[model samples]
Target: MKLSVWTYEGPPHVGAMRVATAMNGLHYVLHAPQGDTYADLLFTMIERRNHRPPVTYTTFQARDLGSDTAKLFRDACQAAYERFKPQAMIVGASCTAELIQDDPGGLGAALGLPIPVIPLELPSYQRKENFGADETFLQIVRTLAKPTDRSARVSCNLIGPTALGFRHRDDITEITALLNDMGVEVNVTAPYGATPADITRLGAAHFNVLMYPETGESACRWMERTLDQPYTRTIPIGVGATKDFVEEVAALTGCIPRLDTDRLRLPWYSASVDSTYLTGKRVFIFGDGTHVATATRIAREEMGFEVVGIGCFNREMARPIRALAKDIGVEALISDDYLEVEGRISNLAPELILGTQMERHIGKRLGIPCAVISAPVHVQDFPARYSPQMGVEGANVIFDTWVHPLVMGLEEHLLHMFREDPEFNDAAGPSHHAHGAKQVSDAPDPIGAQIIWLDEAERELRKVPFFVRGKARRNTEAFAEARGDSQISVETLYEAKAHYAR
Candidate 1:
């Protein structure tokens, strides 16, 4: 694994925990060290779950290496089964426990538990959280899912709603509501509030709705190949996508596509005169693949924003991101490094940023407005309010969530216009002192003392907004320095802008 202070996704076992925790009548026995159990807090604290996740960790210490570490895993599995009385159990090892090679799965299998015992062979060194979740979900479905004659009535299974997702619980509600409105039945939703029996009845559904591609697409595809159950791949995150999703589902189910335009507020909201200020607003997006791709489309199609930069930290799902970026005539930023994302954000100087909590922090540092659109999220993202990122209601939520930060555009423009007046500055003192003062104190001079600039060039730089003048000046100076010029002229400044524009 690469060294990082923070990561977009945790190790494979954390993913397994998500699957185990999201389901009913399922328990996970994790063969792990003491520190590995910290993943529990991700659910209990951040998600504000009242009940603990159904997981039992061995918590084996280094001293246990002298004894039978395998026995500790077995005992944990036995205790978990007895205490939870789960219909099924999953056995796996954490990153550190994998080094011991105790084969927790084999140990659990030997006990002859009454319930199904699924063994997870996740390579923490090679795979990440999303991969683990996918593998675990696939394993559970493979073991429990039973084939049956396709029902004449239209029904589907919603796959990929899991614990710690970005508003997954609400997404299920919204999607369920939409399907009900269209007279379609939801047979089951896997890895999220589904029992082992629900998994067994998966083949009863006529189709599957693949929500998050990273987590459930593999299992959905497998079902399609093995069970002859078709699935819809559209992710209904925005108005256009939601409309298309309804149409696609209708076509598959032979049901009439009906949408209450009033319910989907994004189209109306975007078309309103109040949103005119949002037109051509430069935006930067970076996150996990599903949200990144969906948000990019919404930004460009519905929000009238110019998507200057787009990316994802998930290397496994980078292909679609790269394809989307290529279609938009820009290179996709595919890397796990937050620094690379931060640097791109710095260079782009977008007016708005939509990304994870990490990007929110970077945008805050750079004095740009940001919205959290994806996971690796903070507690603030998991609000008590219903905020799904799917269906028509989800489109409304996205509109409000993304637009609120930049809604004061007119007021900000007026403030900038009147900033030269002493009265205006005095009136804005408190607000400026709280925000602008820090920026002024922290920022170095735009034209550094080391680099000389001609009067015309300095005058041109002054025309730029104070917030961006430093970056503009730095870029110009770097261009002059690269050309071996000691002093910058207005011609050089324009040349630099043109060069950078290319």
Candidate 2:
């Protein structure tokens, strides 16, 4: 079966808006139609954020598409400014508006507001959620960077720190800690906790460290040309790269990243004995280039897994991932087409899959255990813990999630072992339950395999240490509890209402 990732047909800008809305101070004044504002719920509910992401819809429905969008843009800018009193303003359009090309940047420039105004032009024709984040981040920084005759501040910029890209809260905490250790006070970090003045003060940063690669290249180039401040290209993902990343930042900004010797000691599931099970496993990977690249290093060097199939949907990363693919002595699966991605996954036949949510389905169809390694994660994948696929802690998290699928839970493994042992199973009679999911010609599927539910994991986790158990319990319970009742299954829009009513 072929799945098309073509624009407007799949998912819309809701995920992008979720990232924009989750940020604390910034305002997202999107020049989209009325319904596009639905992205607010993805943040408020999914991420459990307190406030509605400050958003303004131009309300330009199909009726308003071509005629007088210019006036609507102006009104949106003015009204959004008046209402939010935002530190900086992000003027953006969704997939629908991108088709019409109402230049919000030009509008932002013409408005002449006291605050920094950023114009975002993300077209539906080409980009997806990651692209939106990257383009929005770079363009916002490019537009807001102020040039002064004064010397550069000791301050530094933290790029690509969006909410969803690395939604794990500990990722931000570790980054801030590393920056403080380097002694270079962070001037700005986007979408997490920066104000309008902080966005404007972006130029004041002596050097910019890119946390996510998608946002790095353009921002780095613009900063270098405009402000004469260079950016560190390397992103810190694992223990070694993080150390190297900090050291390189130290070399540039004279602030050294404190090498946490305890990075390996982090309370990580995969970084411990779990990763031992993953050693030498032929694995497949696909996602944004930054994550894929960082994960490749962690899998190979840190976790001892072999990257068999590699690919990414990012057009910007073609050159790098293509090269990385060749270096590993394998053909990379880089393309926008999901058919081609499915083809690559078929050919690789990996033991485990680290890929997008789409690939999760692909792996399921192919009878392989898979974990989401990139953008477009579902509600199920959030896993409440501070799990980011970056830094030593992240490496550990990756290690565990990937290996967990391959290694059966201890209880399941014990059951299997006991059933095989004559002494343990000879005394018991076997009971059978009807297999009731979709069945086909007796072909192997995920039907009989263990799911490793949160409840089961939690009951077992109580046997673990106290310090680690609380965080694990909180994250696990949040995910399991929030998942609501398992018995309630609604298949479609019509059934959803019936399920809710019942």
Candidate maximizing lDDT = 1
Candidate 1 residue-wise lDDT, 77-192, digit = tens: 98988888999999999999999999988999999999999999998998799999999999999999989977677899999989998899999999999998899999999889
Residue pairs with colliding backbones in model 2 are: 87-196, 88-196, 237-391, 270-400
Candidate 2 lDDT: 0.64
TM-score, cand. 2 vs. native:
0.73
Question: Which portions of model 1 show Cα errors greater than 4 Å?
Answer: 408-502
Model 2 regions lying over 4 Å from their true place? 1-19, 22-25, 63-70, 99-116, 147-155, 254-257, 266-276, 409-502
Worst 10 residues of 1 by lDDT: 426-435
Task: Tell me the lDDT of candidate 1.
Answer: 0.86
Top TM-score model: 1
lDDT of each: 0.86, 0.64
Q: Compared with the true structure, what per-residue lDDT tens digits does model 2 show for residues 1-502?
A: 2445532122324434644664656777777877666765666565656676777888887777657998998998898888878877777777667767778778877999877777676666566666676666666666667875433546677776656554545667767676776576777776456665566667767877777666446667787888888888777777668778878887886654566656664335445775566667778898878778877877777667788978888777889999998999888877767677777776556666788777776665554567777775666666666776666666566656766666542333345346657654412321111123121111222321222334444335434332122333333333433455232211222243333456
**TM-score of every candidate relative to the true structure:** 0.89, 0.73
